[model samples]
Target chain A: MVQPEKARSKIRIYMDILQAVQDDGMAKPTRVLQKANLSHERLTRYLGELVQKNLVKENQDEPGVRYYTMTEQGIRFLQELRKAESFVSGFGFEF
Target chain B: MPFPFLYLDTSFYFLSGIVAFLVSFYAFRYTRLIENSALRFLSIGFTVLGVGLLAEAFIDTLSFFIPSTSSYLLLHRLIIREAAATYSFLQVLAYFVILMGYLLSRRGPASAASSNGSMNRPPTIGFLASATSVVLASRLGELGVLIALAREIIIISSALSMAFLVAIIYLDSTGYLKHRNKQAILVLVGFVLILASQAISFSLGIVAARALGFSEILDFIGTAVQFAAFLSLLLFLIWRGKIGSTGKSAQ
Candidate 1:
């Protein structure tokens, strides 16, 4: 029997988003949507939360053009999240 | 740790404690990174069990080094027995905690996520609960031993704890089956070996009745199997966490 794919966990999503932003140094929403494979609404909401958490910063210095860049905290968070992911999954968890 | 009952092999217990410590460390260290209460409980369970094994190991070492000609032999032996009762208590408690983790995790991921900040006080509470039980059980266990009933009770309780663990591991294996995970298969086999060791020891009566030294040989085999089980899990955890990971598989 074919098993249904497990949904991406919230932490996984966060990791992907952080990685997407970090890869380009700074990223637009569309780029993040493409890289992270998230819907526009989810990317906006998650990015907003990440920004509020100080993991990410959204810049809108130029009118109507915004970019998301990873904070030092965000980079650290991603690295730790990756490690944590590896840690739990190694023990046969869903992660 | 195998319930050798009378055997005080300090080195074996000490090494078992170290292996348990490493496994518990792996489970405990990542709790801050994830909102999984199951992980937290697994951490707590292993931590309690590891501490119990290490403490028992120390007490056993103390008992082992003193000469039989020493005047304090009887008193030290009493201390060691009492310590074994405590160790047994902690072993059962550890299994209970791990079982509770499995039970709670069955409630699904949402509940685990909701439990994020609510768990800060649990370790303290757990410590307080167990500390009180340790005092009562350790002292009362001495009296129980004088009456020759404590060992029986310990065996029964240990059996129940083993039952709980068997059920949990059975469930865990089913999950592993679903995933077809080879690493999990290694873990499953390891657990099976440990359980089989217990089964062998528990039948020591029947085995001993059939032959004299055969039971002792079986005892040695059981201990070896238990040690191998611990070593296998420890090595798997190290490999999975370090060199074997590609970081994409979990995601």
Candidate 2:
């Protein structure tokens, strides 16, 4: 029997949001929702986590409008993720 | 050094230690981010291997300063020979630890992923200390025969270790790991080259110091081949870092 695909890991989800913000240079919640392919609620929750970890910073450009920008720590985390990926891939395993 | 083997061996041990230390440093840093048990084990194993090489290098260095006085010369030679055994013991242990780490990775992904704890340190020190003592206390007679037997055993063990690594890596490529790409090829080539060097040494029966020049030449070639293997791994790690910085595929 085929097994269901395992849920994406937390680090992976972290990478997704970071990448979204990085790609946009500064991402809106809606833009990140689309880029990271996460539900609005899930994106909001993860963004909260990223902010808590100081990986991403949020700025309210105006009333009811917010943008998410990756902090230096967030950028470094993403780089670390990439390195882990490359190293694991060298052994033919998914990180 | 008076003996060519001592000179070549000193250089080999120092270089090997440096290479292993560098690899261990990278491994330890990566483990901090990944938090994989297997990665931590790898870091620890390489660290132990590096320390073993450094210890051997130190002993070889000390051997050079031994006085040629008739009274204590025999004792000095005995100590040097014992140190060689100690070095071999460490080599065997290091490879075994690294092999276990690789095996651990294969047990299941979650096994490595879930264990975010750091490597335990006390057991490592205790194990090394106890093993070294046992090797040191082991009895020996007739230095020439002992050296030959030690070399033979080391060559055999090294060959076996390389074989195990090759098999493990091959399985890694074809199994769930699916690493059958350029990087896998590079790793495989590196291991194979090292295996070949061990095989060459084994065939040469390099234990008896009869043709010291020829034996040193063979050993030099083996050391060079092993260095190349370490170089390939180093190149791969650097390339990986470059890929990481460029924001390419997370894979």
* TM-score, every prediction: 0.73, 0.78
Scored by lDDT, the top model is: 2
Chain B TM-score against the true chain B, each candidate:
0.73, 0.74
DockQ of each: 0.28, 0.48
Among these predictions, the greatest TM-score belongs to: 2
Per-chain TM-score (chain B), model 1: 0.73
Residue B202 lDDT in model 2? 57
lDDT of 2 at B96: 60
Runs of candidate 1 exceeding 4 Å displacement: A1-9, A22-28, A34-37, A57-72, A92-94, B1-8, B69-85, B116-148, B179-182, B204-220, B243-248
Please report, as a residue range, the 10-residue window in candidate 2 chain B with the lowest summed lDDT. B117-126
The CA lDDT of each predicted structure is: 0.65, 0.67
On a 0 to 100 scale, what is the lDDT of residue B79 in model 2?
A: 54
